[model samples]
Target: MTRKLTSQDAEALAVSALVYVANDPVLLPRFLALTGIEAPAIRQAAREPGFLAGVLRFILAHEPTLTAFAEHAGVAPAAVGEALKALPTGDDRYLAST
Candidate 1:
């Protein structure tokens, strides 16, 4: 049986996505450029609120990237959406609250 996802699981998925981006030669530059987060500061930035959500958003922004991450993480692409929703700062949550 499939286990229900929790906030912790979502955080883990986001962390995985961050790691995936960090290790990629191509994606890493883009991620850093877009986020303006230096490689040396990434660990510090990861502790900031909404950072993980941003990582997931970055991954979800591109179909190929999303597919690659999903395949690498052994999860359905849809799970990224679920993990986004599980995050407190997810765009969906902000939209829902507003």
Candidate 2:
């Protein structure tokens, strides 16, 4: 059965996707610029529950590359990587739920 999506789950999905995309070497920049979220912000957001969900929503809607996602998110590539690392990986169910 499909599990209901919690805020935490969404954040995990965002983190997982972000981590996966950040490693792509193509979508990193785009993700940052679109969100206007820097490394500090990314790190801070990771601690917050809903923030990552919003960021992920924007990213999924835009489907930007790593560079584009970075640019779009306004976060540095390194920051994105750091944030992605901080996030949990087990909650990836959000991807299919969404």
Candidate 3:
């Protein structure tokens, strides 16, 4: 059977993709601009896979309250929200410090 993709699943996939791309120095700048994440912090986080995972988790957990924040940050609300939902479930450590 084909499993359907939930909103959360979409979000996790989006985040994983972003994390993977952002870790690439060539794409990091564009990714940071698109996500509105601070460059230095993102660069530092990119070095650690756990940090990237945690950031994704944090984004997911904060989805409900991110609309205004995302708008203010000049990021697309849908994109940010979707990315948030893409966070991995059952990983408390990743979501703890995001």
**Which candidate wins on TM-score?**
1
Candidate 2 steric clashes:
38
What candidate 3 gets wrong by more than 4 Å, as runs, is: 1-3, 34-36, 40-98
**Candidates ranked by lDDT, best first?**
1, 2, 3
1-98 in candidate 3: lDDT tens per residue? 53544655655554554554556575556556655678767656556545444454444444543453455445555655444434454244346564
Taking the tens digit of each residue's C-alpha lDDT, what string does model 2 give over 1-96? 534454444455566666755675655566577766775566776676545655555454553444565665555544444443344442363334
lDDT of 3: 0.51
Q: Which candidate number maximizes lDDT?
A: 1
Clashes of each: 0, 38, 4
Error of 3 at 75 (Å): 25
Candidate number with the higher TM-score (2 or 3): 2
| Per-prediction TM-score | 0.89, 0.46, 0.34
Which residue pairs collide, candidate 1?
none
After superposing candidate 2 on the true structure, give the runs of residues whose Cα lies further than 4 Å from its correct spot: 63-98
Better of 1 and 2 by TM-score: 1
Lowest-scoring 10 consecutive residues by lDDT in candidate 3?
A: 85-94
At residue 37, give the lDDT of candidate 2: 70
